[model samples]
Each structure stands twice: as structure tokens, then as C-alpha cells.
Target: MLPRVLAIAGSDSGGGAGIQADIKTITLLGAYAATAVTAITVQNSLGVAAVHLVPPDIVAAQVRAVLTDIGADAVKIGMLGHDATIDAVADALADFAGPVVLDPVMVAKGGAFLLAPEAVGLLSARLLPMAAVVTPNVPELEALAGTQVEDEADLLLAAQELLESGARAVLAKGGHLPGDGDEVVDWLASHEGNRRFASPRMATRHTHGTGCTLASAVAAGLAKGLPLERAVAEARAYVAGALAHAPGLGAGHGPLGHGWTLASG
Candidate 1:
């Protein structure tokens, strides 16, 4: 049977992030993709124009409907735009035992706030502990940890604190770190230890959906039974490939070439 991953996220009409990106990344990696859209954003590669949030009950219903019918091997969560939506999703997945990859999507590629301010605490409190691995970029890490992250060392330390708080594992992404270095490092911090996945940074405006794509890739890996470290490594590599092959569509930050593997294969 093909591995199934349920993505509980918003709808990016742009087809480059949120549920769209999750579906693309999961399917390209040979997994079945399911979704419970929490919000619908009027956006393209340029930026988010307006957002219409789906009701919390509907969001929860979508999740329950998928889980009870198709079933999922893993779950990837993003862009719960409201506090009530966070509560709804957390309650819906209370019994799920499979790996859950939590991408604390606080902001979009264009600086639009995806997650609501009041809901941040609720997500950390309710969902962080339940996640098998939580992927956070440097800025999101600073917000979640409620402290400043000056360097890679601080990034690692903050990730460890998240483990102490309740997370099973933390994939601390250094892509947003304060640097123009040749390589970007992502650290996987868990109770066992920390491992780093480093790759050359590509200079491009076509990384619009990289965060959503990477988290979904990781979830797809977990659904296929890869270990946490292996999943992170593969997902990073996949994102890199997509970045390198971006078609450069929009005037602003563009979408990744999520189906690049199809051509190569």
C-alpha cells in the first residue's frame, strides 16, 4: 500500500504553498496525500491579498472525515490561522499515533502573518508535544521560543529547549539564519542527540513554497517509515533540487519546481 499523509493546512490558491504544496510534495515523493484546509488565501507568487478562514468545526470535520475513511500514516500541519482552528485540529488528532510533522507556519514568503498572534501559544501548548518532529525556521524558532536567536549555536539551544518543553524532535532550519554563507544547515535535535544536514544555498527568488514543501516532504518520508534524521536529510535534498529547477514564474518570490523529480526520473 502507498503511504498516506494527511495535510491539515490552509489553501494557497497560488498552488505553491499550504495544501497545494503539501499535495504536490507528497505525491511526487510517492505518497498518498489527503488534506483538511483550514483557510483559503487569495494569493499568488506575489503575496497574500486576502484570507478567508474556514470555520473551526469544518476544519475538524475535514480531518475526521479523512482519518476515519482513507486513513493516514503521517500528518503535516501548517497555517492554522486562528486559535480556535488550532484547538479544532488538536482535538481532531488526539488519538492519532502516527508521526506528525508540525511546521509552525507563522509567516508567508511575502511577510504576511499566516498564523494568528493569539494562536501561537495555543499551538505550542496543544500541538507541539504531539508532533513527532517540529520544523521551524530561525524566525519562527525565535517566536516559538520567545527569545532571540543570534547564531547557529543559539538556534541549536532553542531547539533543545523545545525538546525539554515537549517536542519529540526538532528540525531547526538555518536557512533564515543571519548569514550569506555558501551552505545552509538544518539541525535535527532529539533526546538522543543532534545531527546536521547541510547543503549549498541557492540564490533565487523562486523559494516561495520551500517551507511548506520541505515539511510535507518530511511527512511523506515519515509515512514511508524513514527515521527522523533520514527524513529530514531527504526532505532537504528534495527542496534543494526543487529550488535549483524553479521555473521563475512570478514577479516576486516564485514557486519551486515541485515535479522536477518526475522529469529526472
Candidate 2:
């Protein structure tokens, strides 16, 4: 049977990230995708113009409806816009029997804040504890851990701290690390140990929705029963390929070609 995965996230009208990215990632990886939209964002490749949050109760109802019937094998959460929504989602998934991939989506590709400052506290205290794995890019990691990550060593330490704070695992992405080097490295820290995934840095500015895509891909692997480390390994490869073959769309930071097919097949 195909693995079933649910996404609790906001809707990106631009279709590059949030619910749109989750759906694309899950479907492309041979999983069934379900959704409960937490907010609606008026956004594009350039920036986010506005965000309309869904009622907390309504969001909970959607999650309940999906869990009671379809029963997801894994859940991916992104772009939660408020504290109430985060609380509602936490409550809804309290007894979930599947892995949860939390993408701490604090800001948009254009540097617009997607998560409110108040919501961060709720997310760290409640949602982070429940996540099977939390994926935080540089800025999000800094916000959650309350410290700057200057190098790979700091990234590992931050991930360890995040795990100590209750996340089962953490992926501290290194995309924001400055340098004109040949490789980009992402640190994966878990209860088991720390490992890294490295890829040659592509010089493309079209990296919108990368965080959303990576988290959802991890969720897809977990839904299909891959172990955490293996799931992350596959997800990283997928994201790299997506970035390498991005379909040059919008003028500003464009989106990955999530549907890009392998030539071997």
C-alpha cells in the first residue's frame, strides 16, 4: 500500500512552498498526501504580501477529521502563523502514532516573517516536544536555540540542544553559511549520533521553498517506513537534485523543480 502522509501547514498562493510544496513532495515520492491548512499566504517568489490565519478550532477539526478516518502514516507541519494554531495542532496530534516532521518556518524566502514572535514560544515548548524530527534552517535555529551558529561545530551543538529540549532529532541546515566554497553541508543530529550530508553548492538564486520541500520529503520517507537516518539521507539527495534542476520561474528566488524525473528510469 502507498504510505499516507498529512501536511498541517499554510497555503502558499504562489504554489512554491507551504501546503503546495508538501503536496508536491509527498506525491512525487509515491505517497498519498492529505492537508489541513493553518493559514493562507498571499505570496510569490519575490515575497509574502499578507497572511490570513485560519481559526484554531477549525484547524483542529481538520486534523481530527483526517486522523479519525484516513489515518496518516506521518505528518509534516509548516508555516504555523499563530500561537493558538500551534496549540490546536499540538493538541490534535497528542496521540498520533506516526512520525511528525516539523519545519520551523519562521521566515519566507524574501525575509518576511511567517511565524509571529509569540508563536515561537508555543512552538518550542509544545510542538517541538512532539516532533519526531525538527528541521530548522540557520535563522530558525538561532531563534529556537537563542544563539548564533558560527560553524559546523556550533550547528551540531545547536542540534544537540534542540534535541535536549525535546525534539527526537534535528536537522540544522547549512544553506545560509557564507562562503564561495565548492560544497554545502547540512548537519543531522539525533539521539543516535551526528552525521552530515554534503552537496556541491549550486550557484542558483532560485531556492524558494527548499525548507518546506526537505521536511516533506523526510516525512514521505518516514511514512514509507524508512529509518530516520536513511530518510534524511534520501531527502537530502532529493532536495539537491531539485535545486540543481530548478525550472527558472520567477525573477527573484525561484522554486525547485520538485517534479524533476531521473534519467535512469
Candidate 3:
């Protein structure tokens, strides 16, 4: 049977992020993809213009409908728009036995808030505890860890502290690190130890859904029974390839080449 990975997130009307990105990444990684959209955004590669949130109960209902019936081997979570939505997700997944990868999507690439400020506290206290792995970009990391992760030491320290908050592990992405280097480094911190993954950063503006794609790819790997470290490594490599081969679209930042793996095969 193909690994089943479910994405519970918002809808990116542009097909570059959120549920669209999750579906593309999961399917390309050889996993069955299912989704429960928590919100819908009028967005494209350029940026978000408006967002309409689905009711919390409705979100819970969607999650329950999928988890109890079709079921999921692993879950990728992103952009729960409100506090109630966060609670709804937490309530619905309380008994999930499979791995959960949470992408704490706070801000969008064009500087829009995907998550409410009040909802951030609820998510940190509730959902973070439930996640098997939490993927956060540098700014998101600083927000969660309450300290700037500017260097390797800061990266490990903040990640370790955040992991202790309840998540089994945290992937602190270093893609936004400065110096215009050709490579990007990500630090994975867990109870066991820390792992560093380095890859050449493809210089492109088509990195719209990288965080969502990476999390979903890791979810697919976990659904296939790959270990956590291996899953993250595979996700990083996959994202790099996607970046390298992005099919430039829209007037602004284009979407990654999510279909590359499928085309290669």
C-alpha cells in the first residue's frame, strides 16, 4: 500500500503553498495525499490579498471525517488561522497514533499574517506538544525560541530549548542565513542529539512554499516508515532539487518545481 499522508492546512489559491503544495509534495514523494483546508486565501505567487477562515467546528469535522475514515499514516499541519482552529485541530488529533509534522506558519513570504497573534500562544502550548517534528524558518524560530538564532551555537541552543517545550524534535531552517553563500544549513534538534543538513541553496525567487513542501515531504517519508533523521535529510534534498528546477510562474516569487520528481520518474 502507498503511504497515506494527510495535510491539515490552509488553501493557497495560487497552488504554490498550503494544501496545494502539500498535495504536490506528498504525491511526488510516492505517498497518497489527503487534505482538510482550514482557511482559504486569495493569493498567488505575488502575495496574499485576503483570507477567509473556515469555522473551527467545521475544521474539526473535516479532520475527524478524514482521520476516522480514510485514516492517515502521518499528518502535516500548517496555517491554523485562529485560536479556535488550533483547539479544533488539537482536539481532533488527540488520539492520532501516527507521526505529526507541524509547520508553524505564522507569516507569509510577502509579510502577511497567516496565523493570528492570539492564536500563536494557543498553538505553542497545545499543538507544539503534539507534533513529532516542528519545522520553522529563522524568523519563526526567533519568535518561538525568544532569541535570535544567528549562528550555529544560537541555532542549537534555541532549537534544543524549543524541543524541550514538548515537540520530539525541531528543524530550525537556516535558509535565511546571511552572507549570500551558495549553501544553506538546517539544524535538527532532538532529545537524542543534533543533526546538521547542508545543501546548496538554489538562487531563485521561486521559494514560495518551501516550508510547507519540506514538512509534507518529511511527513511522506515518515509515513513510509523512514526514521526521523533520514526523513528530514530526504526532505532537504528533495526541496533543493525542487528549487533548482522551479518552473517560473506569476509576476513575483514563482513556485518550486514540485513536479520534478514525477517528471524524472
Task: State the C-alpha lDDT per candidate.
Answer: 0.93, 0.90, 0.91
Model 1 C-alpha lDDT per residue in residues 125-210, reported as the tens digit of each score = 99999999999999999888887887889989999988888889999998998878998988899999998788988889898989
Model 1: how far residue 17 lies from native, Å: 0.8
Q: How many steric clashes between backbone atoms does each model show?
A: 0, 0, 0
TM-score of each: 0.99, 0.97, 0.98
lDDT tens digits, residues 1-86, model 2?
88999999999888888999999999999999999999999988889998899999999999999999989999999988888889
Across 148-209, the per-residue lDDT of candidate 3 in tens digits comes to: 87776787788998987777899999887666877888999999999988887676889999
Clashing pairs in 2: none
Task: Point to the candidate with the largest TM-score.
Answer: 1
| Candidate 3 wrong stretches, greater than 4 Å | none
* Per-candidate RMSD, Å: 0.7, 1.2, 1.0
Q: Who is ahead in lDDT, 2 or 3? A: 3
Selected candidate, larger lDDT, 1 vs 3: 1
Worst lDDT 10-window in candidate 2: 256-265
